[model samples]
Target: MIDNTIFNDKKVAFHTLGCKLNFAETSAIGKQLTDEGFAKVKTGEQADICIINTCSVTDTADHKCRQAINRLNRQHPDAIMIVTGCYAQLKPEEVAAIDGVDLVLGANEKFNVLEYIQKLDGTEKSEIHRSEIKRVREFKPSCSRDDRTRYFLKVQDGCDYFCTYCTIPYARGRSRNATIPETVAMAMQAVEAGAKEIVLSGVNIGDFGKSTGESFFDLVKALDTIPADVRFRISSIEPNLLTDEIITYISTSHRFMPHFHIPLQSGTNEVLQLMKRKYNRELFAHKVELIKSLLPHAFIGVDVIVGVRGETDELFEQSCRFIDSLDISQLHVFTYSERAGTKMLDIEYTVSLNERKRRSNVLHSLSEKKTKAFYQNQVGNTYPVLWESRHNGEFMVGFSSNYVKVERQYDKKLVNTIQIVTLGEWNDDKSALIGV
Candidate 1:
């Protein structure tokens, strides 16, 4: 281990890309460096170390990772540049070939970064430490607070579902997680750090119990026993795994908020089969219907991919119709891009890039309309809102229990505090409701 004194006063800057899970892992890395006596780099100050956590969800994501690496290297010319996460794991050689990267750590080696840093001797080429992702079995628990009051807790890591259109299982490894007690402990730590809301994030959170003998339901029940005033929200879960029992439990629980994020990917069964997804459109609709029936005011966010190799024009139109029929609160639309070394290439059909963009825009408009309706329905109803530390223009913003974005005039006292406020009409742009 490196001596604490040697690391003292060493400032480190972190750049995290992709999911909330990545951010939580970056926070964990920051805490590790802090414990070794490193300070975060302040603005206008050069860092002794620059760590970039990369993503490979899309080709665009990979390009952004490279851009971030180049940008950070330019920003900190002399810093020890470390690159880790999905992009690093999937393309270690490519990442190492980048001009100024000092070290590349894969999924298994990312958390052991301190050991690698101690031996960093400015070698001519970037040092790479990557294990085959399939061999990765250790689950490193992590949690991170956003600028706001919500803290994202990574209850699970990796994925086993290798949907043909996705590279997540390859980049992240098989689905695994820490024990329920350990996850509950991490959540308690976040609460102690003054977290009012904690979100459970992961690659396949519904597949959480694979490593341990416990179930996701068991984990939730244990979390509910915390007896804190904090609320919990589950990140995107597989529709097949989001059972009726779990929905019923959350609908009645005071600790769990009325919010759900489910990935539908494609709404057409033929496209879903081509994508090798576990469930079909009927199952997806059932999950949505169940959530709405149990919790009418819940905020239901759905993930959809606009184009894939097998999605034909008819399939896409069918997808749009099915998605439009759903009573979801919003849609997180992602335009598809081909990735290397995936089963998706076996399929022949392809959506044009222009068509992909048009489809994404169509879904975005639908999302806005649904979100507006959801927000409009909340007007005149008082809900507990956890105000954040930041402000947007003249208004301070907060999210209601059901994830309604509410804005009120900036008040210092409201920061990091919970208050019940009735939602007012939307602003001129319809971005958010004015709260009182």
Candidate 2:
């Protein structure tokens, strides 16, 4: 039997590499460790245990994970190393083969991490406890307390829509979520903890009510009723699932911010069909139009994947043109990468790496132009900016309700406070709106 004295006065340091959902999970893991009599190591401080929560969305993410493991191995070789999250869930054997991983856990196993760690003996071989993704059905609700200004509440988990170029469903399992009452309680807890904003994150948040009988709209509506000054934002939702009711409710709700991030993988119907995306170009365009019509000052962001399988030059041009015609504030362009066991790998044609980068550049340039125009349009408007704790040399930055980046002279009292400020002319060189 392992001795429990090993954990006495232990310190743990955590590093996460991925999306907001990953951050929420990592924060939850940190809370678990802290509650178990472990101290959280401050920045630049060494610890007895190191946890690396990893991502596996693309080949780049996997490469970065390996590099991180090697770097951490050098920094804390003797520290009890734990690797978990999407990358570990999908490839536990591969992660266990890393140089310093002592324990590797999957989606279902991560929450039970303390139990698994107590049984480990600091051997060369990694003790992996990853269950199959198909078997992970229960939703273990998590909320990030890493920052006092904002909270990432994971109201939903997993995805059922196995997109052709995606491995999320395989890494995170099927769609599941907490009941409405449970979600409201979580939000209230965050508010009680002094959070100014709450960002809802999930693998497929629009499919929230699949396992539970609660809809996304119902959950948000209940959240709006919570007696807190915190605002709400949806990280990203599928175009098909962003119903008109949700849009209308957000427009009327005082607590819901005027921002929507909807994923429109491709404007070409053929490419979208190959990606197994439910919404077509027309549907996506209609959704954007509806948001613009209802909330004129709303910030509409689109997520687009360029150079997917079978994306010829003609189709790419069509996509560019389609995006250019939309009234979006910005675009998140992702260059497609081949993932093993994904439907895209078995597809007939493949876009070259050079072609993918070229397409990505084109979309990035377009996004810049759209963002500049959006900022310019808001020059004379007044917005309530939620200032964060981050600061440059002389200026502190914040984001408005519609996701506009605003900057002002550094002031200690302004951090974490929402102040109504009028936007002045854009400073093109800095790419920020001047706050008056």
Candidate 3:
């Protein structure tokens, strides 16, 4: 029988792993618990329930999930353990097999966890329930209201493209998008709930319009129509989906931030072909150049994989040169990690760990230099920063129309407000922009 007495005044802790979408969902789930009279507690403390939102992007993710469960079991052995998210969706059997896990809810059924737990308490037995994502209607809500300043609105989900090196297509099933009216309503709701900025996120944001007759452009147009005091930004888009028209539209929209993060897995055409990326280096360069031409101070972040199967020193150098030759503001370098059931895992001639580390370091060093240079260029420019809560001893801060981190002295009033601040010289070797 479900034990309603256990959660009468109990506390809950959530540990989230993965992308912005996962964090948004976690916040939503936490809100649900809080609304039901359960108290939200910090991690590492003893609690009545522990929810772990997992990722399956890389093999390291799997290892970390297992390690986290083991640690949680040691700390709070008696607490109910719940596992959900991509890892849970992909490998429910493996997760349910873990000794301390009390429940495993897959992607489609995870949102209804409270009811499941209620029933579980009545039965006193662990439960496993996962519905295939393909047959579902994207059950979760589209808006996020937990954050005071920024909200991640999931405008799209799942992916149809089966990139040779990706497992998202299998884990998430197929491409799906929220209707234009529904997405705009959520954006407006977030704005009403004190959100100063909205970030549109998804698996493949560029393919947002394929399922519906609406395009990303249409979504942006509708969002722009919302008379909100908040700005908007996109998470990541494929080179092919990031068309010139979209770039031009963002350039003119007052609410759209001048930032774009496009994933360029590899710079060399041969490596890109092997990775099954749709666009080559030349087309990727054009997209960056077009964005820059439209908005000079725009922050163009590129996602590059350092070491994939069959990567040579020459190929690595080519990748580095391509990035060096771009007008991008920064780089998000990822060392390729093999994922189970992905085509790249079965590819012959894998690079050694040391080689991968070396390439990763090289790209990281270059990224630092590029980032510092970008900050240096903004020295005299004044931008609007949306200040966040305090970090270590300093106040957590955000960037302007273009994404640049600027830190200032602590101010409680600026927590969720956008203020105009001038960028000063680099403060430390950390390359953080000091605000004046």
Candidate 4:
């Protein structure tokens, strides 16, 4: 029998290894553990229990998860180690087979972690509680308090669209979400907890309210009415679901920042069709144009995946040229990595590792140029920037309303507060705008 008294003075730490959605869920789990009498600590701190929220979007992610487990087990051999999240849901048996893992929970099972722990009886083998993905139909609202300056509020969960180079639908289940009223209440709660910014995040947030006869636009409209002094930012949305009305509404909203992160996996129409993406290159370009026309100072970030199957050199060139033509601020380039059971695995004409790295480097250089040009444009303009807690040497860093990073001398009074400052020349690194 396990000693129940051990829980009275146990410390627990959590480490999340995925998107903002995963971080939000991990924070919710941490809050639950805290409510249940477990003292929360940093990931590297000594703890009686350690929780790893894993991600399996790429093979490298899986390898990192394994390395973290091995490292944690070596450092804390007597700790009760638990692993959960997408990697745990998709491959419970594989994760359980890893030495030093005490329990493995799936997408639906992670929420019931306390119940599962109560049933454990000092078992030597790793306990697995994964269920079929189809059975995960409930929507659990979560928000990350990992940072006092911002919180990632999970307004939606799961995905109905199974893009060819994706395993999120299989890992997180179908599209579902809470009602607009419920989500607004959650946002209010976050504001009460001292959140300066709340990022609306999810697997496929554009598909929000599909199960409740509502729409993503409706959710945002409701949230805009919240009487909190917090700025709201959408994490990412599908081009097809990012309607013109939503863009126009946000353009006029006081609380919503002038920033949008849209994923355009490929700029070539043929590659997009191969990836089963919903929108074409033309439609994506039109969306960018619309956002630029409405919110002239908007910060637009594009997500591009390089080196996917069927992406020939010619197609990659076409993609690079098309991205170069866009009036966006920055690019988040992801080198495509094959995942097990994804539709892309069966597709022919895969790009080699060396070629993938080459394409990724080209995009990275382009991203730097685009970001630098965007920063240069804001050199003379004054904007309201919300300062974060972290500082670099004597400088404090923050992001403007349009997501421009600004730095000033460190001041404790400026933390978590929005200040209006005129932008000056870029620093030596040119990574951030400095206050004049």
Per-model TM against the reference:
0.98, 0.97, 0.93, 0.97
lDDT, candidate 2, 1-436, per-residue tens:
4354656689888889999899998888878777777898877777888889999999899999989988987887678889998999989999999888999999999987788888887567889998988888889888995443678999889988889899999999999998988888988888888889999999899888788877888888888888878999998999889999899889898899999999998989989999988889999999999999999989999999998888989999999999999999999998899888988877888889898999999999999999889888999999999998878768888889998999888898998899999999865565789898
**How much is the lDDT of residue 327 in candidate 3?**
88
Which lDDT tens digits does candidate 1 get at residues 148-233?
Answer: 77899999998888888888888899999999989999999999999989999999999889899989999999999896889999
Distance (Å) between predicted and true CA of 367, model 3? 0.6
Against the true structure, candidate 4 reaches a TM-score of: 0.97
Give the C-alpha lDDT of model 3.
0.83
- Candidate 4: pairs in clash: none
Which residue ranges in model 3 land beyond 4 Å of their true spot?
1-7, 42-45, 121-126, 137-139, 145-148, 391-396
Residue range with the least summed lDDT across 10 consecutive positions in model 2: 1-10
Clashing pairs in 3: 1-121, 1-122, 1-123, 2-121, 2-122, 3-121
- In angstroms, give how far residue 49 of model 4 lies from its true place: 0.8
- Top-TM-score candidate index: 1
Among all windows of 10 consecutive residues in model 1, the one with the lowest summed lDDT is 1-10
- RMSD of each predicted structure: 1.0, 1.6, 2.4, 1.8
lDDT of 4 by residue, 1-436 (tens): 4434546667887788979889999988888777777888665678888899999888888899999988888888888889999999988999999999999999998987777777777879999988899988999999886554888899999999999998989999999999999999999999998888899999999999898999999998998888878899998999999999999999999999999999998889999999998889999999999999998889999999999999999999999999999999999999899988888888889899999999999999999999989888989899889999988669888999999999889998999999998999997677798985
Clashes of 2: 0
